[model samples]
Target: MTAGEPDLVGPEILDGHLYDYPAYYDLVFGSDCAAETAFFEDCFRQLARRPVERIFEPACGTGRLLYRLSRRGYSVSGNDLNPHAVAYCNARFERAGWDPPAVLGDMADFRLRRKVDAAFNTINSFRHLDNENAARSHLGCVAAALARGGLYLLGLHLTPTRGPRDMGESWTARRGHLGIVSNLQSISIDRRRRVEKFAMSFDVYTPTRHRRIEGILEYRTYTLEQIRRSVESVPSLEWIETFDFAYDISRPVVVGNLTEDVVLVLRKR
Candidate 1:
């Protein structure tokens, strides 16, 4: 799908990331699919009661993880609210001669006819729930879809209880003659509500045109206690363990010590 024309300001431009530019989603962020998928596979083997065969991904944009996991011989299915991204993912799978299972569905209220052995919401995608109610609903939906002893691998950076912290990160990716540089920034932090607002700007360079696409990306930040509460509310899921981005299952989560990113491994009861 073609991207919308650039608009630097206003709520209209605050659409979710990749809403307007689904074509660049995989090119810009899916380069590490192999390593990330390996890490997830490790968690599944370590935490799941039975061998994992069926996998599901919520908010599986660009289907990078879905594609990689499928290639590795798992029954992979995914859902994203963005119809365009979902369309692109389905097309990609069909082009590869596989049946497409990706669909347009909201995380807060999605269900499948078949249960999965494991499910995931990686790279801060869980944060997109944006509020307590929505977060609970999404968790409930995921829990309802898991088989007994199934696993849920969730990855995100917890919001610190300490004073404010501002960070920025940028990366560049090129495809043939087209190059795109993306800058991600945390624009607001609401400690009272445990929410953070983000802004992502992408500069696209092509032979005929150069443009910027940017928007607000909000997250419902979770402290350790907050995450515990959220998970506990869904009795079907038991908090199994927490690991830093390094994906070490043996490492313990120290309350006062944490890296910028964490992976929470939960098991179905």
Candidate 2:
């Protein structure tokens, strides 16, 4: 353990990093690993004009994607606000010695002396910036850190329509196992703020036990139109493209390229 790393993986709760290792990424991604990797790799191949020699992954939780990309010959540099996540990624990369320092800092104001060929925030992490100013600051920072004509890719979920909040729920019971209720939900937008209040709650069962561990996640959403206004305001940034699902298509529907999330590829204009 490093100076500030937490001791446990699941239920051991790190101060800033996510608890429940191996499971965190799995749950968030839910069996979409290979597809997601291929998506990111394809983006890199196109935007950087080659497989990027050195790349940056901000909010690189657990370093799963970083490790995968590094193995493919890309030098991976990463940073996250969570100390526990940084420590865990460091340990995993130490064996291969490919791990650069994954720093702990504010994503909005991070600085690196060495520039990267490409920079990315994968898996909808950009939406977590919380507000327009933070998002703009982050965009500016990314533009500044890239070498000339470097690529920037961001994959994030589109803001849900703030009209009707649809909530659905389901439960499952296994043999001799505890019953659990999974939450499926949505929230309407706050039209004034161009944000939505998303709410979700889940109840989990212990192994073969019936006690439910419940939690909730709330989010503020940004619609495509809203995001467009913000992206267009930055002088050094250009929104080259957006992919909701597939990166390969001729005259793909740009506006509708959004479902669960949107993937936007940008360049320093």
Candidate 3:
């Protein structure tokens, strides 16, 4: 049940495109503004006021948040199920003069030897659970990690109302240093997978040439209602804030929707 190099996965990178988790993340999000992203993560930590002695990111691909938190004076540790990701994190930790937290099996249900003061799922990471039961199990996992009053912060998403949405795609580049891609992503749920599939057919082209270096990234989504229902089942779960991403409009967006996906700050009761 260990997650190490032999068990990790990276992009086969066949047919001119495709990478495993780290390659996929580097390609998709591009190496841009990592500090900015980390700032928000620290914001969550500050908001929760939890002394994050040991932190866990279930989907810590390439150690994005883990790396940032470590740089910022936190004793950070994490587990990424993808072997490629886990390997990358281990290397990063070694280079940083730290011992990488051993990655256990799947995020759906994992048990760490050490208890943590806080844990989080940021940037819609919680949507990976795919089904209701798995999400609930993970929520319980979070509760078990806490010390009676530990905090769990999640930047989750609500169900997107179906429509064209003027969804467009675009890509940008930065001379020879790096390339940037901003594209329209359409995410829809498949009842069979119980997971929302985000379809991206965009490419990051070389600077000035505008030739497409093929990048295909697909991430399945899970709904906020599913998260709420799951977390509620945990005996000591308590939800404090319900932040909205409504863009300051009159009412909420999307029909048949009753929940606002927010940075759910949960305290183990």
Candidate 4:
């Protein structure tokens, strides 16, 4: 069976934790791995002051990007708060006959034995640090883990100043005999508290088995000004440029009140 393909068994419904199933998570999110990896390399080439030979990823679920980067000849390491993700990543590395560096660690406060050339945490994972203190600490930690002049690519969606506050999206992906249909919707949006509660559900189908998984998650919402202030709190890192989800290094954008998706390029001072 391929990765993420469930065994040929009976039908079942599970109220499962989303992050606990790394393979299925990869199936949903890993399709753009090559594009994202290329984007990272381009960012390093265009924006980084130092050669990005060794890179790190925080909140690297399943090491999907890490594995791809390693294959591309860059030294890669990452950490995740989920033990299952850590184990899954390490297992993949071991299968490839490479040393595994994914470890169970918190993104807000974790240390690396050696500094890296560049690091990244994308796709709004940084918003998981639900408080100002934790967000500041995560920035400080990433700054400390980089050499001088190193770059950190942080990507997230900013809270919109206008329009509908509630939002959602759905995705469908298939690998081999496994098919997954996933939906993510905001159940609650509290502007005053800077929080958004999300309801996520996945319907999986195999040849002989069908499973439905559900999970709820929360992310801290940040306006453009709020994120700017948070970045300013860490003096060692300077925000250099802002890009949108397109991941195009050639086009840097000015984040205005209307902008939502943003990728901030920070350089260690």
For TM-score, the strongest prediction is: 4
Q: How close to the true structure is residue 260 of candidate 1, measured as C-alpha lDDT?
A: 56
Residue lDDT tens for model 2, 168-263:
334332223322344445545565765544444333344532222333344546677877877887778788877765544232345542344567
Clashes of 3: 6
List candidate 2 segments past 4 Å from native: 1-23, 49-51, 160-184, 201-213, 246-252, 256-260
How far residue 113's Cα lies from its native spot in candidate 2, in Å, is 1.5
Per-prediction TM-score, please?
0.88, 0.75, 0.70, 0.93
Pairs of colliding residues, candidate 2: 157-261, 162-189
Question: How do the residues 204-245 of candidate 4 rate in per-residue lDDT, one tens digit apiece?
Answer: 877666787887889999998899999999999999998887
- Tens digits of lDDT, candidate 3, 1-269: 11111313321222443225354455454444364345445545554545556677776667766777677776666666677777877787788788885374566788777777777766566666656677788888878877666677666656544532323345543435334344545555464565544444333333232222344344445455555567789978787654433212223234234443556667778
> What is the TM-score of candidate 4?
0.93
Q: What TM-score would you give candidate 1 relative to the actual structure?
A: 0.88
Better of 1 and 3 by lDDT: 1
The local distance difference test score of each candidate is 0.81, 0.63, 0.58, 0.88
Best by lDDT: 4
Point out the higher-scoring one by lDDT: 1 or 2. 1
- Candidate 1: tens digits of C-alpha lDDT, residues 1-269: 11334534422333445554777777788766776788888878777898899999999887888988899999999999888888889998999999997998998989889999999887888888878889899999999999999999988888766654447688888777677778899988887987788888887766556666787778888887788899899999998787776655667576542445678888999
Better of 3 and 4 by TM-score: 4
